[model samples]
Target: MPSGRLPVVNPWRFETNQATVQIKVGTYYSQVWTRAINAWNSKKVFTFKIVKGPAQITILPAQSNEASLIKQNFVGVAYVNHDNTKRITSVQLHLVNSLLKSNGYTTSQRVNVAEHELGHAMGLAHNPSKQSVMYKTTRYVSIQPIDVKNAKDLYSIPASQYFINLPATTSTTANKDVIANGAGDRLFKSPFETRSVQALVDPSTIY
Candidate 1:
């Protein structure tokens, strides 16, 4: 709602303000993701718990450059699943571990990237302010006040406004390709275009 912040359209948000997300990793990277989740939980507006099993929100390590469905050099991607009503039912977060290290992201930056992607999953759009974690690209290592305010504002909106109505007619092959890409839900891409940091959304297929 603040000025200078980029608007987010058709935000895919959860039904409630509190929910746990499952991380798909069993490595040190999981620790970094935990930190990101903790950072967002700090706002007290929402709580993200790390759980197991087939979760509504899933976090996993990107296997290779092929993880990028947008054909750009990206570090993270988040796919959201919404029903015909438009409320988000599930989400998938993909992080490129090898690319992050090779591209020189420090432990803090890695955590920041995780946080940024999670923000996308939460339905926050890219903000233009460099100080905000929702910015399209940045070296920021954590969430800013504006980012928190943005989250608060986003959640405060009516649920009906957060969703949309899309056509139901879709192809089976496209669905298979999305599954093969590991984008377990509908694709939505992060707006960032460079090596700094970003989230992901797949627009090629419909679900």
Candidate 2:
């Protein structure tokens, strides 16, 4: 169990501290994901096993309108799908190459974004502190001590204790829509492209 105060835990999580991951991005981005995985694995609070077939977490390049996302300054996004009991079934992390390239984000910065999204997949909410990788705009940060502590603390709790009886329409039907139709809660937005927007407090921020 966590020895200190707990960080914010998302309503969903894997059954354990480890999860299978599959990366479907380009070579460069694949390396970025790999580095991100290694960074988190170094923490030893959680583990991500690489797999070829269906995986609990899938990381892929975003196929959305690049121009629109660039305009919005979004670097990446994560969608989480869970069962009725709020156990996360699958997570899809989409990295925006167009935005990353156009904005001239360095390789390390891109890796930071990947780490941030992966944190969401591990059941972490955005941290208000800018020093943590789970912050809403996390391109400038790496996984900090708070991040490791939060992840370790979250997994220490029993899965059953996290369950909440959400409305049937939102929990059941909405989740099916997410798995089948790809319409679900957008759990995280990696980083904003423009520094101006990043400076402001976003009320709808989730990652």
Candidate 3:
């Protein structure tokens, strides 16, 4: 399976098995982004749908200057937003049109960059293997077994925390009802409060 440098804290992950991505109707590079989305959806690990409204993931076109500001020589990139506890809330991906053109990338190569950025948006890190789409510098146009294995492993690991602001009375009432019913409250709730938790095997071992 693909391997990568672990973040200082556990990586954030999507709450659901499926995610919605938004692309502007007439955005430049829309074709390549569509091809990339199809490439990822071909895998069974998760499904990605395109929507016209707000979405968990948003893909946009960028200029060569914007791409360079984010990272030198980057043709595409993905960014994730997380709370203090490391739960992923949103992701944004950018594709540099000028950079791709300057690099002399063909349609297939643009798709490869899109696929790689999407992998990062889905909590995938840079894999060392050249055959994997998550490689630091992508050489593959399609997702591979290493990519699939790593993605599945990530989803298998549960969130490390759930921090919701609730009124004291309502929070207490909810907890009481949960415990009274013998539900799995102990794993994530207390009689009158909620707290962060470290659940299950380490993500590194899931693979």
- Prediction 3 TM-score vs. true: 0.68
Clash pairs for candidate 1: 187-202, 188-201, 188-202, 189-200, 189-201, 190-200
**CA-RMSD of model 1:** 8.1
Clashes of 3: 0
- lDDT by residue for model 2 (99-173), tens: 677667789988998898898888887777989887777667899999998998888887667655553222232
Better model by lDDT: candidate 1 vs candidate 3: 1
Q: Which is the better candidate, 1 or 2, if ranked by TM-score?
A: 2
What digit string (tens of lDDT, one per residue) describes model 1 on residues 1-207? 546754442345677666678887867778889998998998886788777777778886555545443345456766655545446666778776655766677889878878888887777766656676765554454788877777777777666565455542322223222122222223432221101123532212222
**lDDT winner:** 2
- Candidates arranged by lDDT, highest first: 2, 1, 3
Residue 69 in model 1: lDDT: 38
Off by over 4 Å in 3: 1-10, 25-28, 63-67, 158-207
Give the distance in Å from residue 14's predicted Cα in candidate 3 to where it truly belongs.
0.7
Query: Which is superior by lDDT, 1 or 2?
Result: 2
- Candidate 1 residue 126 Cα shift, in angstroms, is 1.1
User: How big is the positional error of residue 166 in model 2, measured in Å on the Cα after superposition?
Assistant: 11
Lowest summed lDDT over 10 consecutive residues: which window, candidate 1?
A: 188-197
Clashing pairs in 2: none
